[model samples]
Target: MKKIRYVFYMPVWRKGQWKDNFIGYGIAIWTFALNCWKPKMWKYIRKHFFSHVEMWFPDEDGKFITMTPEIDLEPFAINSVPQFTGQCFSSTMRDAQGVRFALASEVLRNPRRWWYIEATVTDTRYELMLLLAKRQEGKPYDKWGLFTGFFMLAPYLQNDDERYCSDVCAWLAWMANILPKRLWIISPRRFAWLLVKNLNRELKPLVKGKYNGKIQKHSRISRCVQIR
Candidate 1:
């Protein structure tokens, strides 16, 4: 059996149109900088975007994070796409179709900054993703998917704006809450579309730049997808 694990990170993507075609870099930049202060940064971020955050803590890896109780909602985009089978995500509901999921310890967002989830994962896809991020080996970004059973959060829609979070980031976060220890099954296709939706024009400006690249790659989802 072929085994491959994928890792992903954000604000990471293919080169876009402008020399600096960030959807909203200044905002995310400010937030990343402010995150240095923790309490004040958390307070300021919650004021505008989050409806309510559920958890916040520091991990063994020195990653301090806050968790938000994910709102129970399905993704709205796939509603109209018939090609997508019955589910908010085609990869999730189908059996034998391998989808990747990361265990989330927190939900952090800033209007002009970022929306992130930190988790542990195993049995993932898209090896190319990590090779590109240049993260440390054995770090969260270091492994790919497998039957070995590990989990971690990859990239997510950085925009948790009040109007969009429900459809964009909350469902995945909710999924993480439900299956905190199991492989959540990340789908490259699903996340690729996520990037498309977040970066496209006509959508309200959530951040500053277009995030690019594969969220995760599918090797042979046949083994994982169930015939439902």
Candidate 2:
């Protein structure tokens, strides 16, 4: 089996685009409000541009498989379940753009700074992640956890049946011994920061001028889709 690596999907906002949106405004407000007490947190918020993250593994067929939580309100859970059965580096959903496997590493091509991690994962660790994903399949998305995480100022909010995007990601990492602790009530952005800080100390920014040879070589998603 191909070694599994974690892929962090950043939100792609055009230049000068975020300044006009609610997300931009909200981030700004939070930065201003918590910068003093949470300087590290503020720095993390400022550094990350992408809004989402997911796990990827190479399947038995040699094709890469991606797993992430999809928001589903009807059953009030992360309904897509494992989200494990698809082409690697492909788009998560049909309508979304800039989300394909091609773009997974493609974001690094841009001039703006982005974060991506590639670690040599063991077969046991990979299977652990799969088991955790199986348990979380069809779980509810924890909207309240998202709110209370911030409100209560604790990531470890009440653990119930539901889970939000970051909550599940954080949980899986903790369970698999990837993340050090249960960083309860976390956001995707914060989770990204924590992963880099806690796990990989050698993490570096993807600068504009540098050639992306590492990604091209390591990101052997599949032969059917040429990376270039």
Please name the candidate that would achieve the greatest TM-score relative to the true structure: 2
lDDT by residue for model 1 over 36-58, one digit each (tens)? 34453353343333221111122
lDDT (Cα atoms) of all candidates against the true structure: 0.25, 0.49
How many clashing pairs does model 2 include?
13
Clashes of each: 50, 13
Please tell me which predicted candidate would have the highest lDDT against the true structure: 2
Show where candidate 1 strays beyond 4 Å: 1-9, 12-16, 39-167, 175-228
TM-score of each: 0.20, 0.56
Give the CA lDDT, 0 to 100, for residue 72 in model 2: 53
